[model samples]
Target: MVAKSAKLTQLIQAVDGQKVHQIRCGDHRFIDVTIVQTQGRFFVRQYKFSKRSWYDAFINNPTIDGLPNGAMKIGDLEVQINGKVPEDLQSMTPSVNQAYRKLLGLVYPLMRLTFDRQKHEATTLELIPVFDH
Candidate 1:
């Protein structure tokens, strides 16, 4: 719906027809992204610009090349996790309760994005996408 990044707009247009599509995270889950076509459709992963770890070992190590895979396949859409709270809520500290709630709110779109990975077009969050919708 809303195009925040010109790169993303170009990606969607890059493979404007056919069926299956995918994008690669070259730098990390945040920095580099390249769109690829499978049969025809488009796919996008979650990435952020700030998450790139400029460390040597994680970057130079051959085994640790080209971003961690956080793009979960649901159907058509990929749930690109730019960041996530690795620990379960039950195990969270009491002081982080506010943070936990905020996280849930942030991840709600991601949860819906799950359906997109599955190629389910009926994806909707409480019957809404944008707040102004």
Candidate 2:
């Protein structure tokens, strides 16, 4: 659900470094990701899913860059994901899985049956707060 009172910046701050956020875009299903504060800016890591990556789904559309207005949540609290797999993805998966184990455990098992790690790409989604319409 889209938050009516919470600004994107506030929401980012609320979850940054402390918790994981699940974000859903357009008609896509929700995925648990994090809001990382890096190099004095914020970014969301999007992993490539089996068939398509977040970058693949939204890159062609210019509307996503602006991310206008509100952000989405699942049942009150959650976040977003993005991008293609990185070159070092194999190395990264172990830690990524551990950090998000509580969340991933529920979905990873079923996903492992059909999900091939090599099929996806890792990319970053820079979160720029769009305050006004």
Candidate 3:
């Protein structure tokens, strides 16, 4: 794991309680994402197969112009991505997943987010923080 810089730590604390935030993949436009912070790490799960562009983007090219290709922006602070979490440790806790489902219901009342634990577990991606130099 990369050491967390003061800026990165502050950014994590600032958004840890929030259910949703905007993330940008490479040069793609920012998209609303459900983020969760656990074990001093941040994670984003692909709730649906159709919404896998961000994941695909990262896998295709994790870096661009020698800089990280992904980022999560919270106001003026941006947390750079180190890379995806390994498959073995990608799954979030059940409670965390339940909370995410509740958040989705509140955030998108018209849309129904399914509760397929297996699928969600497979889609979870940890946002390893890139420490500032």
Alpha-carbon TM-score of each model against the true structure? 0.19, 0.45, 0.70
For model 1, residues 1-133, the per-residue Cα lDDT tens digits are 5454543444334434322333222334332322222222222223222354322212233222323433322235443322222233233222232322233456546655554433322110010011111
Q: Which ten contiguous residues of candidate 1 have the minimum total lDDT?
A: 122-131
lDDT of each candidate versus the true structure: 0.30, 0.48, 0.65
Sorted by lDDT (best first), the order is 3, 2, 1
Candidate 1 off by > 4 Å: 1-4, 23-133
lDDT of 3 by residue, 37-126 (tens): 655667677765664577766766756444666888766677777546455563455545555555565654333345566666666676
Query: Whose lDDT is higher: candidate 1's or candidate 3's?
Result: 3
TM-score for candidate 3: 0.70
Worst 10 residues of 2 by lDDT: 78-87
lDDT of 2 by residue, 78-114 (tens): 4332332334555654554544443345665666566
**Model 2: per-residue Cα lDDT at residue 98:** 48
The candidate scoring highest on TM-score is 3
**True-structure RMSD, every candidate:** 15.8, 7.4, 4.6
